[model samples]
Target: MADKQLMTYEVGEQMNLMALLKNVTVRVAKNGKQYLDLTFEDQSGEISGKFWDASAADIDRFQAGRVVRLAGKRETYQGSPQVRIAGLRLANADEPHQPGDFVVHAPMKASDMEEQINQVVFEITNQVWNRIVRFLLAKHRKAFFSYPAAKHNHHAFEGGLAFHTLSILRLAHSVVQQYSSIDAPLLYAGAILHDLGKVIELSGPVSTQYTVEGNLLGHISIVDGEIVSACNELKFDLNSENVVLLRHMILAHHGLMEYGSPVRPRLLEAEVLHQLDELDASIMMMTTAVEKTSPGEFGERLFAMDGRSFYRPNEPQAGGPAVK
Candidate 1:
């Protein structure tokens, strides 16, 4: 029988892990034999794995979105971590965990995030923007709190969409405090609506992927279209100054055209929104990478950060538990 006790993944150590098959593909090795290339994810993080010389039944047994117990030896190839699978099996019904147990989740509960976001919606004093935001928020409330912000990278977990918006809101408040010239209501409204289109862009939390609309139009365009629709539905002029400014914030949140923003931030509030959004996302991505790294060493390279690998400083904080 295969080992039931799961252990941590460390190079030169045998790993007995219960993980979600986050991604699975049947590929050919150099010898022309088939192999199962897999991504195994647990509460801790994810790692690449391969079941070499896969059989017909092996292909049938392993699949993405399935929970499995894996027995493998962790090793490095070309400086990247990978597991060479020796034994693997589908998780039994009687196992203590399930697929949901493996996918990552935001720190805040969905209910809490929704409640707090609802309050922030009211904080948007511009009645037109407030009405548009309320209409859209109500329309996509379920997916807003349930979808991940991205298919991967920072905040690619359950409730991450809402959590990420909330994080930006928190940052926006501080920015407003620091710079009195910034319009609080405009910034808040932009923060709320910035990534709301992701609900349409991404399929959902589990095995997240881009939807057809997402691939064709992208989130920025999708949300801008939504705003136009909401204006027509609510009898607000789509070309009005405030509506145009709000749309600019959404379209310019990416900060640059190459990154997908159709326009650069032209308003003061729009600029602040762009910077705050970038700040929160950068911090989240780096933090996620650091948490997965061993203390005193650098983490995997961040493709989002120009392929730079951040060093996980070995020194413990003044009050927190030391990183191990």
Candidate 2:
């Protein structure tokens, strides 16, 4: 029989697992001995491990992001699963280890997401807007497809940035159809380029964290700056209406000043972008919370949603009254 995945290991089970050593920290125990506090991850999930009385040599041997073979037993501490490591060593060259096997990513395949995004880009008809969007997309395609939308919160897995962008573009399509007054080209470009700055803002796909720029300028400002630079490089008129409107969409996507938008949305397209962005993020966040909670119970308080816990209903509601 195949071995159980990391998430399936139950408390008290002896596990001989191979996983990526994602993080490591040295701490002094009460007895004055140093110990290694580590995080191990495989595609299924991640677990913490404590190596009691670890020496300096051990720290050097098992660095972060390296694959390691571990013999341990699972235990629960503060309602979370952790492992007590009895033995561990760097995974040897002969081991059947693959980096892709250890990373958590968006549910959709990366290639599929990229194709969908490209299709949306093809839909943009404004020549200058199309050129600028295509140029930026081609430049950042690698990181754009690999990076998570955020370190944590909604769409916080690999390929999340692309997944989130594509999701918003799909929403924009429906919104344009519903309201023919909305400019389809401008809305489509706004949806595609809304979060382009995150590629520079985030560290990378694995162990995602905010970079110094991400903490200071944030994605909104970063992408706004990118828009200016891209236009300058392409020799597109700085004062062109399309250029200014696209920049406005990125800067005001957060919707309000307190939410990190430098300026409140002023244009109809910008306002639509803000609303669509919020709707997508809120749906993903609430859906994720609901899925993680036990049926008939409330999920943990969500800081993003004003510290409210969502209830996981035991059953789906029946269809409501049909529209006459």
Overall lDDT per candidate, in order of appearance: 0.86, 0.84
- Candidate 2 Cα misplacement greater than 4 A, ranges: 10-16, 23-39, 47-63, 70-89, 96-98, 315-324
Candidate 1 local accuracy as lDDT? 0.86
lDDT of 1 by residue, 80-113 (tens): 4678888899988887357787887788899999
TM-score between candidate 2 and the true structure: 0.81
Query: After TM-score superposition, what is the CA distance of residue 185 in candidate 1 from its true location, in Å?
Result: 1.1
Cα lDDT tens digits, model 2, 139-220, are 8989999988987678877888999999999999999989999999988898988998999999877766689999998998
Q: Which pairs of residues have clashing backbones in candidate 2? A: none
By TM-score, who's the top model here? 1
What's the CA RMSD for each of the models?
3.2, 5.0
